[model samples]
Target chain A: MNQKLFFTTNILILTTIAFVSIISDIGAKNYTYKQVNASDPWARATSKLAKTGAVYIKNIHNKGKNAVKITGFSANIAKKVQLHNTVVKNEVAKMQHIEFLEIGPNKSVQFNPGGLHIMLMGLKRPLEKNSHFPLIIKFEKLGNLEIMVDIKNIGWSQKKPSNYKHVHH
Target chain B: MKKIIYSILIILVFSALSFGVFFISDHYAQKWQSNKLFKAKLYDVNGKTWSIKSLKDKLGIIYFGYTFCPDACPTALNNLTIALEKIDSKKLQFEPIFISVDPNRDKPKIIKDYLSSFDTIILGLTGTDRDLKSFTFNIGATYSLSREDPEDENYLVNHTVGFFMITSKGASLPIPYRNNPEDLARAIEQIKSIQMSNSKFKKISSIF
Candidate 1:
């Protein structure tokens, strides 16, 4: 009886560890977003006719540990994928190479156009107007989630209509 | 015989004066004219004519290239965009202007659309191919075209990368010589310094 009880305890401990591991892996939120501070964010393409599409994903919400991983994502039209950041050095905007994103604890990160963005480089063809590209985002812990991004023309703003944004000279 | 000799002497004097003036002008133009970015009439992407002189107080970054450029032009533009962020808005301002060297393919609409991707302030300008070549060559600029794909109706254009920094008073500072990012930044900084100094010598004497 004693032997049987010890064996049962050992099985329970092993099962608990296995279940925790599985939960952590599957619980990772992939491409999850929420409001940063406000809904309005600056996003624009470098050209009205650029073969590329960039959007500002702001007020991102990726709480808890386990550095968020974004990979295995494919766009229907984009030939290559990259995350590009425009860092200011000596008052000049320089492109920096980035790989993954990490939002620690309650902190959030924003990917604003002309600043930091995920460049869908080398589009297989021009992204047609009125059509959206589905981005398959994968996370190490959360598995996979997909987001459909709208390709807006140059000078596009997420701000509400009837708003006149100032053009600073 | 005396009358003929006197007339010959007058003729010799005039010829010498003309030669002296011609030599000085040519030397000045060759040394200083090519570096200045002067204001001139340019066609917008909509084919409407415009000029940088319209922005009298602001400085302009004038770049010459085609919309169909595969890589360098866009990268240069991107670098310029990055470089502009470093400028202090209160002291000086830099506006980027895209001048299409290939007028055949880069129409007003195409140029406008290409420039629209960046900030709204960036202007896109183009003109007839002949006009573009004439204007570019006059500045000692060089460019060439190569077919991208014979199979396709559309083709690519390859050209030199050159940008001019023109101020409101019509003074131009040719930068990068060939579109190097470091050179661009240095040129902008130099412009900013000149503006900050509040120097009286803001206007250029020659136009290339």
Candidate 2:
């Protein structure tokens, strides 16, 4: 009976240790970063003399408990990468610099034309369509995510209205 | 049945009254916003003096932006270029004018170089701070300059994003156009309609 009791105690202690280790492994993971899904990354092509352009991405945070903040961005094509928001007030469109963009858990943030975007300043060369470039996005919690931005033509986001008809004189 | 009829009657009367009020207010608002042309002297890319009165006989599309603008101005200008290319210039005498809000950075040479990337026909104009203020304010356009350092060459100027259509009579039509082919086409149609009506009115008056 004594030997049996000792055997039972050892098994119980081993099981507890295994369970705790599993829990700790999950807890140590970078949960906030794992939940961030970025897609549809694109940049507008600039002219030869143009030194700046913008990049857009659709960021979706899957985690429902914590918000993810985009802290910084880096691209080889530009000398400076800054997060910007286009604010339209009283018919005037103003581009304002933002420190970070926070997306709530289970929410999405679309960076598109006439809205929030990543400004790429001092471009080394003009962005050409069908060409891709690497963009590293740093997050407050998720760390850094490397994304490939597809270069598109100017006014790529503008779609003709369905009711539009050609005007002829 | 009588109560329901009374409620229906009251709602109808209120709806009509509200529609009438909105229509009248909109009419006055449009009148207040239109037909006011401010005169200013601006320098073109060729260093020629371009007065506001010079645009009187032509249908003008005035755009307020800077040369250093990365996305918005270039995209807008490109769209204008495409739209102008589509239209027959002989049918409608329209001109696209790009006015620089950042006069400090957008000099004549800079404007000329910047505009060369887009349509060469686009007339690039710039003016002094005093000249821009009088012109922009009268046209209901606004822009702000943000400089982190006083001497920093890398600064941002946030200005209005769209284009304003000026009628041949030099009156602003109050409707702004986005950098889209459809919007430009629509504005052209409206201008043609106005031109037609004005010519008809002139003919009738001449007959009298």
Local error of candidate 1 at residue B57 (angstroms): 2.8
The estimated TM-scores of all candidates read 0.47, 0.67
Residue A17 of model 2, lDDT score: 100
Which parts of model 2 have CA positions greater than 4 angstroms off? A1-33, A58-65, A128-130, A158-169, B1-39, B52-57, B78-91, B119-121, B167-169, B177-184, B191-208
* Real interface contacts reproduced by model 1, as a fraction: 0.25
**Highest-DockQ candidate:** 2
In the range B14-96, model 1's lDDT, one tens digit per residue, is 99889767766865664454333342346876778866566667777777777654334555676676567655434346677
Judged by DockQ cut-offs, the docking class of candidate 2 is acceptable
In model 2, the clashing pairs are: none
Question: What TM-score would candidate 1 get against the native?
Answer: 0.47
Give the lDDT of residue A108 in candidate 2. Answer: 67
Off by over 4 Å in 1: A1-169, B1-41, B88-92, B148-152, B167-171, B177-183, B191-208
State which candidate has the highest lDDT. Answer: 2
RMSD in angstroms, all models? 14.7, 15.9
